[model samples]
Target: MDKEFTPRIAAILCQWCSYTGADLAGTSRLQYPTSIIAMKVMCSSRVDPVLLLKAYLSGSDGVLLGGCHPGDCHYEVGNYHTRRRFAILKAVFDTLGLESARLKLSWISASEGPKFAQVANDYTEEIKKMGENPSKKKMFL
Candidate 1:
């Protein structure tokens, strides 16, 4: 049998920070996996837990919430709120016995093109380690 190496990842990027970084990644021509489906939000703090779960249910093997650095939210303190929200959401995902590695939160500033590339690359590798999510087994075509 041959091993498969492609991965499907969902990236939820805050428009202010992480999304811009991703854009920079594009303009810089830094190559990363094309598998990511980027969902742009105004702020990471705005990422509701329900939305995260919905993505999993929708077939993405992994979810990455990208946000601004602490104290850097254009919306003023949005990232601070996200810090609190991510903690609780992670707890719930754990209680549900989902792979913790399936969810990730990253802060990538608009100027950090390399950072965005690295994060995407690293996350792709992490989900690969986790292998196919068991929930995927139940997904119907």
Candidate 2:
């Protein structure tokens, strides 16, 4: 891939799981795309739909949300809420003429460093094929 054409991915990760897993990936030196710009949150449920939209509008080619697996959330039902929210968000994306494939949700445990790296690589490649986010074509107020 051309260095200048690399996709820019904005990721929101739950601190208890996904963030820890990413930290582990870093400490372990697991190779993954550097295209990911990760932000840590207390829970996946805290990732507001508007935040994700803003990311794409701000020029991110893709947005990734990572959290604990179902029934494994540190906040009990947090991931469940995230699941529901993402479902709604996907619908909104479709209604807005956006490609739902540009957004991804993954469950990563604190012990899953390799998984985190793999997810990062896979999502980056997927975004590359999809090209830039169409939302960037419009100006956001």
Candidate 3:
């Protein structure tokens, strides 16, 4: 019997904003897919690009990066750094023949619980349409 396909998502969230937003989503009883696994980071800028690549290569169908809005990062320019890095990461994925759409970045404040839930649901659906990550079948040495 063939097992049903379910997209796996890795969410790297900023502790001050996105992670707190996710917590609010939970406390507010917002419903989202269980396919997402979230990790909290001190800042979005602290998330290495390699970690995002590794998540996809390791079988995550999609990766979600959430951070403070522009000009609102607690660390002053952290989100700016994240924006630049994400742009480069997308370019690298495209050059490698990977679908860059599998990666997403969103600005969510701690007060935006509804937005968090909406993003999660929407991104989950998008990933479902994209199917599984092709790299999952490849052997990387």
Candidate 4:
């Protein structure tokens, strides 16, 4: 088993919930992998599937989509929109032979800061096991 750790991860968090949770994580001083690069959006629905494509095309090893846990969207069902978009996005990744494991979509509320940290750590570990994204080399080379 050839295993190496590449910790570059792009964390796209909804301004409503996940972002708040991330803030709580900081206030609580919970330490997860610092590999996460956070990008905030007013709504998770605002995260276009194109961004995910662009991230992997650039240099991101993983793209983590976090939202308000389905119906809890502050924008009212914004998370639903995100969920549907990612469903198709994941399918596209599969069709292109890009490792779908590199993309993650999760529902975490503002109160669940510890959960947010755990998710970040868990996803990071998962992607680390998968190694670098194949799309990175395929697109660049």
* TM-score of each candidate structure, all chains considered together: 0.91, 0.92, 0.94, 0.92
The per-model lDDT (C-alpha) reads: 0.85, 0.91, 0.92, 0.87
lDDT of 1 by residue, 78-121 (tens): 88888888888889878978777788889999999899999999
Identify the superior model by lDDT, candidate 2 or candidate 4.
2
- lDDT: which is higher, 2 or 3? 3
State which candidate, 3 or 4, has the greater lDDT: 3
Question: How do all the candidates rank in terms of TM-score, highest first?
Answer: 3, 2, 4, 1
Best by lDDT: 3
> What does candidate 3's lDDT look like per residue over 20-101, in tens digits?
9999999999998897789999999999888998898888899999999999999999999999999999999899887999
Q: Which residue pairs collide, candidate 1? A: none
Off by over 4 Å in 3: 1-3
Q: In model 1, what lDDT does residue 89 have?
A: 81
* Clash count, one per candidate: 0, 0, 0, 0
> Where is model 1 more than 4 Å wrong at Cα?
139-141
In angstroms, what RMSD does candidate 4 have relative to the true structure? 1.9
* lDDT: the better of candidates 1 and 3: 3
Clashing pairs in 2: none
Local accuracy of candidate 4 as per-residue lDDT tens digits, 1-141: 435465799999988799899989889999888888898999889988898888977868899989998778998888888898999999997998777888899888999899999998899888888777765667445
- RMSD per model, one decimal: 2.0, 1.8, 1.7, 1.9
